[model samples]
Target chain A: MSTQSVAHDQPHASGGKYVQIAVILFVLTALEVALFEVSHEAGPTGFGALLASHFVVILLALSALKFWFVAMFYMHLKFDLKVLRYVFASSLLIAVVVISALFVLFTYNRTLWWATGVWK
Target chain B: MTAAVLDHDSADAHEEHPTSLRIDSRKLAIWTFIGSECLFFAALITTFVIYRNSHATGPGPKDVFEVPLVTAGTAVLLFSSFFVVMALNGAQEGNRKKLLLWLSLTVLCGCFFVGMQVYEFTGFMHKGMGYSTNLFATSFFTLTGFHGTHVAIGTLWLGTLLKDAYKGRIPPNKALNLEIAALYWHFVDVVWIIIFPVVYLMSLFAK
Candidate 1:
């Protein structure tokens, strides 16, 4: 989404596109930092809890957007062979599953320990 | 005899890869390696996240992270990504001077990023947070240290390529070399993108 026109006769993205993505990334990072500061100061009660939840979701969404931009545009995965995309995506998918499973198991164990007074 | 030898050398330089997929085998290999590296960094990151709040008696993300400083560093890495692609473009176009200029700039940006990490780690250590300080500290250092190491390696790789470019070695036919390096560089930047939010922003606010 850049207005700056780039002249390219190749199959790859132009410099203008990369600059636009970089600007978008910068904006998203700024938003993440701002959300963190606001969340850090939020009170410990009702409205603050709601704000914090929203903050976490938006912060994560911003991160994902940044990741997508870099992976797709900068890495040229968007224009490269589809098989290469699957190779990277499948590995990422497995990583997500493994990490999520571990997080869930750890959270459950923490809850059980807390109930049994196993942790202070 | 000399003309025949010269033609042989140029033909070899412009030789096409004969592959079933009609694509370069070297490119496929780099992508495969990148895929494996994805899982590798994922495991490190997941470990960091799991131990994010497990700092028994050490400083936490909220206390240690300087968002402004890191934002600058992130900008540097992102710009370096852009630079590498531009450098590749120059290489593909066979503009030796353009290739050398952009590659040098990219390498400089990478060095600046590594320097920032060194400063950050030193500051943390001075503040009593070592590798063995706590789970949070250990995981933080490990995840980020590994990334910084990758950036350092990438910088060295590009530097070597820059030397070759200066010697008039990286022509359009050999642009795949720069392309492969660019892919690795972009991957490193993407890892930091994840790390910035997951490790820094999330932890700073999760507290």
Candidate 2:
């Protein structure tokens, strides 16, 4: 809402930084795609197994890094007020909590349903 | 002379509204709105993740998603964020030509992304994977369709801002208007940055 006031009051990143960040993002994305393809062929040991087993973890990590770059630079969160940072961070924390709770509840429910011996 | 000085001081006082923290009210409001949006998108994404593999008889992500095409679309969206920022810089620097050029390019990228989604959706339907196909199809469409809607809305928002730039209404002091829209646009792109890998790439492998 007030990006207007801040844009005038604070100095923003130069054009070169924006382009550099963009390039870094492009490389990260390409790496993500490449890893996806490579993991499909990585047998079942050493680095391949690690990548195959932890595919989601690796993807999420890379994704988080990309998210940080965009949020910090493009969204100007790095230079904004502490209040704004707290607002966004708190919401994201709540979201993570909710998502984790859902996953746990669903897992527990599935086990209970499968264990209910009346049907068999 | 006293009267003229008093009038000048009154004008200066009118420009500076008293605030406890000196924070821009609009900036706080927008940040709050964006925070709420984070939760909204989180819930949707959680739903998609929950039902990601529950396709039953319908096609799954691996069968329908094309990584190469999505990568292209993602690139376009990322570049547009850069474009909008440059446009905002132009606006702040009072370079109308630079502002218009970058803003127009940003809008074009937005349109291109939406067009890619439209094409991808139609292709899915052609492959017999409609929204009601199963849980997987349903959640996938719901998540992505909502994202596409956001992009479409952003495109319209930027289009209006670009029109203003062309008409010479967006001066340096008023650059905040464009800045707010750019924030929203960048936020949209950020959401896709998460979605692309989670929904598309992660789903491709055997889980």
Supply the global lDDT for candidate 1: 0.80
* Candidate 1: Cα lDDT at A29: 77
Report RMSD (Å) for each prediction in the order shown. Answer: 7.6, 7.2
Model 1 agreement with the true structure over A35-82: per-residue lDDT tens digits? 777677777777656668798678778888888988898778888877
The complex in candidate 2 yields a DockQ of 0.48
For residues A2-109, could you state the per-residue lDDT of candidate 2 as single tens digits? 233333365678888888998999999998988898887788787877788888888899899999998888888887767777988898888889777987897687
* lDDT score for residue B71 of model 2: 95
Model 1 misplacement above 4 A: A1-10, A42-51, A113-120, B1-17
lDDT of 2 by residue, B1-207 (tens): 121112112222333443344554555566676787888788888888888899878798888999989999999998999899999889989999999999999999999999999999999999999989989999999999999998998898888888889999888877777777888888889899988988898888866
Model 2 chain A worst lDDT window (10 residues) = A1-10
